[model samples]
Target: MKLLLIPDKFDGSLTSESFANAFVAGMKKSGVPFTSRYIKATDGGEGFLKVVGKYKPCISIEVISENPLRKPIRSYYLYNKEDNSAYIELAHASGLELLQYDELNPMLTTTYGTGIKINDAVEKGVKHIYIGLGTSATNDGGIGIANALGYIFLNDKGEVLPPIGSSLRLIKSIDDSHVSEKVKQVKFYTVHNVINPLFGKDGAAYVYAKYKGANDKVISDLNKGLIRLNKVVSDKYNVHYNDVPGAGAAGGAAFGLKSFLNAEFLGTIDFILKLSGLREILHKESFDYIITGEGKIDKQYLNSSLLQSVIGLGMEYGIPVIAICELLEISKEDLKEIGVFDVFDLKDEQKNLEYNMKDTAHLITAKTAEYFSDK
Candidate 1:
């Protein structure tokens, strides 16, 4: 029997590569006779570059910046010299993980560090910049990023506002005269997840503000700021950004990029899938079972569309696909309807998830080996 195991990272527990390694070790120890292959799939979130790292030559560029709490943080960017292309993952700077529980205030956090990365890349003379926008701690609509690029947001008093989302409402004028000339020549692609608009109930504040420790009043203030910022940018660009797809990504950072930087948005998963040659791999291999897993399996997994794509590919080849997840909260019928042959939970027979990962992995591999060995 042949097996393919492709999984995303288990969030904070294990990287995709590490998870693959663990699964392989368990398989070998259990005397599995089947051939197995593992792939680290990226939905254009954190490992987007590494999945396609071979296609793009990466050069490290040091970027001096600050995290969400204004703390010093030294970051690096990936530059592809061939196309003069550079990519920066937002998690590297000013990400949600960079902040402490007490430091997750949407009104105070800023994407200034992310801006620094972009500026550093632009100064290197890159023509195309791809910014992966996810896991941000700030709710600002990219004002802080523009501030780093020399755009000033001023208040009615004619004083520049501090870099924050809640302050975007007070901007009486936006000054772009101080921006570098090179910025105009550059094009930007914002890699994102959601396709929601920039404002209203479905917008950044109401959708993601609570995750960053925003309260009811803070959410209201943030939505107001986003509305005003959206108007200012729409007027400047003469393009409506209120209902644009992906504008709500990264706490409305996509909206800010659209209005301020003239950037286009692409779903991270679809982008990464094409770049990683996943289609070619799927066509080239024939497996008895295709095993895929994530940290959790819920309604969102069915909605991701990337998973659906993978499942569709598996079905086209008549390969059985099973899911092995940390948590399985969906109904069995739903799993079948989505083309999942079976769903297994790693947390179900164990009390401590972290402590039991190794043993659980061993058990899963052994079970797989026994199943194939009998066949």
Candidate 2:
């Protein structure tokens, strides 16, 4: 039998690399003799670069930048030379993980680090840039990034606006004169993990800002800033991205890229699955069963994420797919609706949240191996 040990990170518990190893170890201990394949599947989240490492060596670049809450931090971007492409995972620099619960303020955070990374990629002469827009800690509507790329935001008094939400309304003119020549030649792709527009009740600020520590007033400010910034971008560039699907991603970075750089926006899972050649792998191997999962499985699993892609590919071969998650939130009917034959949770029956994660992983691996070997 052949199995694919493909799983996203367990969030707070394990990284993708660690989960892959533990899963394979469990299969071996269960005495399931099978060829196993490992693939990193990041749906524009923090573990994105770790998964991409399976395919390429990442080029590291350093730049002085600020985190989501405007605190200084050093960040890195991964460059894929073979494809002449660069990947910017915002979480790697200015993500929610960079701040504490109390520090999560959308009103003050910015995408400045994200912009600096893009500038570094351009300087490296990359022709294509793919930005993974998930786990952001800001609501600046991509103004911080555009500023780094030479799109100056100014007030009526002709003074440059500070890189924050409160100052977004001060914009009167945009200057693109200093934007590097390479920027015009490169193609930009925004990989959005969610489908939210830039400005509306369901827009970035209203829906997601709360998680970033926004109160009612802050959310109002964020929305206003996004509205103003979108207009500025559209009026100057002759494009409107405010109502575009996925425009609200990464705290309006999605809208910013679409309007300013003419980037192609795609579902993060779909793009990663295609790039990883997942379908080809499934076609090459005909297995009786496929086991797939993430650190946790919830209603969101119905979306086109790593586990969903695995199930879809398995169905093509008439194979049953069993999802093994660190935690499972769906009912049996819901699991069926999502295309999983069965769902397994790795948590101990008697333990609470503080259960030893390593032991739990081994237990899950053993159970998975036994399930296949029994067949």
Candidate 3:
């Protein structure tokens, strides 16, 4: 049998590449007569650049930037000299992974570092830029980026306001006279992993701020700020930020880029798949089974275009798709309805969190061996 192993990162434990390696090792140990191919699947989040860099010939450039807390750090991006294009993963500079558990407050975090990365690419005279927006640690609605690009946000007193989430509601006007001319010359594309809107109950602050360490009060404040910022964007740029799909991604970074940088949004998985030629590979190669999973498997995965597209491809090719996830919240019937042949949940009754973390790879390998050995 020929099997394709494609999985997303297991959050804090393993990367997609690592997960694929573990799965391959298990398949080898199973003693099953099978040839396996591996591919890293990402939703334009943390591992986007690593997966893209695997197939694309690009130069890595490191630059100085700040983290969510405005601390100086070194970050990098991939540049394709042949196409005069740059690929940026937002998480590299302004990601939640850069922070500790105690420092995870979105109200204080900023995307200024992301802007610094973009400015670095722009200064290098790149003609096109593609940015992956995921795994962010801020809820500033792109104010920090705008600030870095020379757009000054002011309060009612006409004094410059700090570019942070809490300052969104204090912006009385925006000054664009000092905005970078180089930024206008480049075409920007934002790869969005989610489809949330800019404001309202399902919007940026309401749905995502909690993950960034917002309390009930902070969430409420952030929501109000998002609403006010939407109006400001409409008045200043004549763009209705709330009308755009995926505007809430990365805590309104999508909205901020669209309104200020004239960015066009694209689905993360589709863009990555196209860039990696995965669809063409699927069409050309014949495989009996396709395996995929992530840190968690829930109804939310069903809403993801990434998972949906994979399922569609499997159904079209008549290949059975199996999932092995750290957590499984969907039922067998639901899984079948979504074209998943089976699911393997990693949480064992006998294992605790610490044990699971330490033995995730081994457990996955052993389980895969046992399951296919029976087959």
Candidate 4:
């Protein structure tokens, strides 16, 4: 049998590469003869650079950046010399993982730290920048990044807003007079797999702010803020981005990138799949099963572009799809509807998360052997 492995990282446990390796080992141990294609992938949120570097020539450029609270931290981005392009993972500076649970409030958080990273690259003369936005902790729109690059947000009193979510509803106007010429010239791309709009029922604030630590009242206020910011942008620029498919991503950071930097958008899964030559492979080869997964299997996985993309490919090529994850939480009916023929999870019910994560490779190997032993 020929297997196509393009699994996602198992959070703290395995990268897609390592996941593929363990699965293959299981196949070998099961005495199943197989040929395989292993491609390392990311959603372009966390492990973006590592996947990009596998196919592109890039170097890590380290700099001092700020956390979502405006505190300083060390971070880095990938820079490709060939086209003077830079790939920045926004979570590196503004992700939820950077904050403690008590510090998770989005109202006080800012994307200013991510802006600092962008500004640093701009200062270094990079012409194109790709910002990966996901797992964010801020709901300030893009004002934080704009502030770092010389745009100022002001309240009705003409006092500069602090570039936080709490200030969103208070925004009376914007000051772009001091925005640098270089910042204006560079091309920007918001990279992720989000399709939500900027600010309404399904917009950034209402859908994502709560997860970023906002209560009902706070989510309401944050939504109002985003509304204000959109109105201000429309009045000033005679433009609208509030309804754009990806404008609501990263707590409206995608909105900011577009309204401020004139950014375009890219889907991480599509980008990685195309760049990895997987589509090209479809021209000459076929697979018995295309394997893919993330940390957990649930309803979100069913709606996800990652799993959907794999399923689409499997459907197009008449191949079945299988998945391996750290845990399985989706129903068999859901799997059947998605065209997944089989699923495997390596979770050790009696073991703690730490132990399971540490022993993931062994677990995956054993599980894989079990799944294919009869076949």
Candidate 5:
């Protein structure tokens, strides 16, 4: 039997590479005669630059950028000299991981730090800039980034507002007089795996703010701020950002880039699949089964469309696809109807989440071996 494995990180538990290794070990333990190949791929999230570096001849350009609270931190982006292209992962500058438990308030957070990285790349005369948007720590509608690129947000009194989530609702006007002329010449793309809208129940603020430490009132306020931002953006760009898909990505960073910088949106999975030469691989090889998974197989994962794409690939090749997630909350029937041949979860239900996470590698190995032992 031949298999191909492609998995995402199990959140805090295991990386995709480690997960694949453990699974392969399990297969070996089962004494199954199998040949397998694994890929370390990312959907333009944390490991995006690493994937880019694998495909492109690039160098890391380090720059001092700001954290979510406008504090200085060292960050870097992948710069390709051959095509003058740059790739940036947003979390490198303004991610939830950068904050302490007490510092997890989205109201005070800003994406200005990410903007600083973008500005650094822009200043280097890069013709193309691709930003991977995920795991952001703010809900400021990305005005913070605009601020860093010379766009100014002002209150009704014409006073400049600070670049924070709290400032989004108070803005009455935007100024681009001091914006760089070079900004208009560059091509920009916001890469993400979600298809959420700019502002509403499914939008950035309502769906993501709670994880960023927002209370109900704060979430509502942030949602209102996003609406206000959309209005302002629509007025200036003659584009209705709220109607756009994927505009809610990274706390409206996608919307901001499209509205402010004329950036296009690229789905993360498709972008990576093409760049990683997955199609080329498929043409040269055939696998009996394709194994793919993430940390959770819940509603969010259902909406992610990553698995769906993988399943589509399997269906195209008449190969069965199997999922091995940490927890599978969705109906097995639902997944099966959509081309998944099987689903296996790794959670040790007898134990608490802490133990399960701490020993995920073991659980994954045990489950894989047990499933194939009798086959």
Candidate 6:
């Protein structure tokens, strides 16, 4: 059988690259006489550039920037000189991964580093820029980025306010007189992994701030701040992005960019697949099965364009699609109705979280061996 293996990062246990390697190693050890092709999948998260850079020609540009906590760090972006286009991952500068557990306070973190990266790219004369927004450590509503790009936030007393989540409530006016000239010439595109809006019950603060270490009071404050910022943005720009789909992505980075930078948003999987030419590959090659998975199989995965696209491709080609995850939260019948042929979970009766985390590669290999052995 010919199988296509395309999996996202398994969260804390394995990256996409490591998971593919382990799965392939297990197949080899099992002596399974099958052909396989591997491709890494990313929904604009940590491994975005690694996967996109695999298929696109890009020049790496490194710059000194700040982390979520405003600490100086070296970050990079990929630029294609031929098209004068650049790709920037928000996580590179202000990702939650850049901070320690104790430092992960959303109200204190900022996206200033990401803004600095954007400023660097714009100054390089790139005509078009694509930003990947995911796995961030801030909920500043993009004010931090605006601050980096010379958009000043002022209090009612006309004093500058720090570009942090807590300062959103104190902003009296946004000053754009010092905004970068380079920003006007470029077209910006934002790729989003989720479809949540910028404000309300399903908004940025309510939906994501807790994960960034927000307490009940902080969550309430952040939500109010988001509401205030949304109104201010609409009053100034005459455009309301608060209710737009995907506006809540990356802690309102999408909403901020859309409101201030004229950014267009695209679905993460659709854009990446097009960039990687996955459709062309599927049309040209014949495979019996497609295997894809992430760290967990939950309701959220059901809404992911990545999984949906994989299932669509499998159905179109009359091939079966299987998912192998560390944990399975959905019922088999539900998964089957969505076009997944089967799910192989690492956490069966004989395994637990600790065992799976400790020996992920071995477990995956053993499971692959058993599955094909039965077949």
Alpha-carbon local distance difference test for all models: 0.76, 0.76, 0.85, 0.86, 0.86, 0.85
Q: Mind giving the per-residue lDDT tens digits that candidate 6 earns over 1-375?
A: 788987888888887777788887777777768888887677776777787689789989999999999999999999988788999999999898999998999889999999999999898898999988888999999998888988998889999999999998888888999987889889999886677787777888888888899998998899889888988888888998888888888889888888889999877656866887877887899888898877887875554336766777688889899888888888989989989999888875777788778788778888888887766
What is every candidate's alpha-carbon RMSD to the true fold? 3.2, 3.1, 2.2, 2.3, 1.7, 2.3
- lDDT per residue for candidate 1 within 1-375, as digits (tens), equals 688776767777677777677666656665656687776566545665676575567787787888976788988888888888898887778688888899899999998889988998888789999988777898889887889899999888889898797787887778889999988889998876566678788788887789899999999999999988877776766778878866877778888787778897866545655666666776887788877767777774553324554576568779888777777789878989878887666764635666555455554555545544545
Collision count for each candidate, in order = 0, 1, 0, 2, 0, 0
For residue 286, what is the lDDT in candidate 1?
A: 75
What TM-score quantifies how close candidate 4 is to the native fold?
A: 0.91
- Model 4 ranges off by over 4 Å: 301-305, 348-358
For residue 36, model 1's alpha carbon misses the true position, in angstroms, by 3.9
Candidate 2 per-residue lDDT over residues 206-289, each given as its tens digit: 888888889998888888878888777778888887888779888888888877687898765467567788767766776666
Give per-residue lDDT, candidate 5, residue 285: 92
**Selected candidate, larger lDDT, 1 vs 6:** 6
Q: What is the lDDT of residue 40 in candidate 6?
A: 67
Candidate 3 regions off by >4 Å?
29-31, 300-309, 312-319
Candidate 5 lDDT over 253-328, as tens digits, reads: 8888888998888876567667778778889999988988788887666655468667777888888988988778
Tens-place lDDT digits, model 3, residues 1-375: 799877777878887777888888888888899988887666777877887688789999999999999999999999998889998988988899899989999889999999999998999999999888888999999998888889899999999998999898898899999987899999999986677888788788888789899999999999899888888879987888675878988899989999999899877656756787877887898998988877777775554435665676688779999888887888978989879898888887798977786778887898899888876
| TM-scores of the candidates in the order shown | 0.85, 0.85, 0.92, 0.91, 0.95, 0.91
The runs of at least 3 residues in candidate 2 whose Cα sits more than 4 Å from the true structure, single-residue gaps closed, are: 28-33, 155-159, 167-178, 235-238, 273-275, 300-305, 308-320, 356-359, 366-375
Query: Which pairs of residues clash in candidate 4, taking residues 3 or more apart in a chain or in different chains?
Result: 168-225, 169-225
Candidate 4 residue lDDT tens string, 1-375:
998888888877787888888889999999989999887777657777778788888999998999999888999998999999998998999999899999999999999999998998998999999898888999998889989999999999999989998999888999999988989779998877777888888888888888899999999999998999999999999889999887988899999999989999877766776668877887888888888877788764443346766776678789888887787887867788878877877789999988988999899899889889988
By TM-score, the better pick of 1 and 6 is: 6
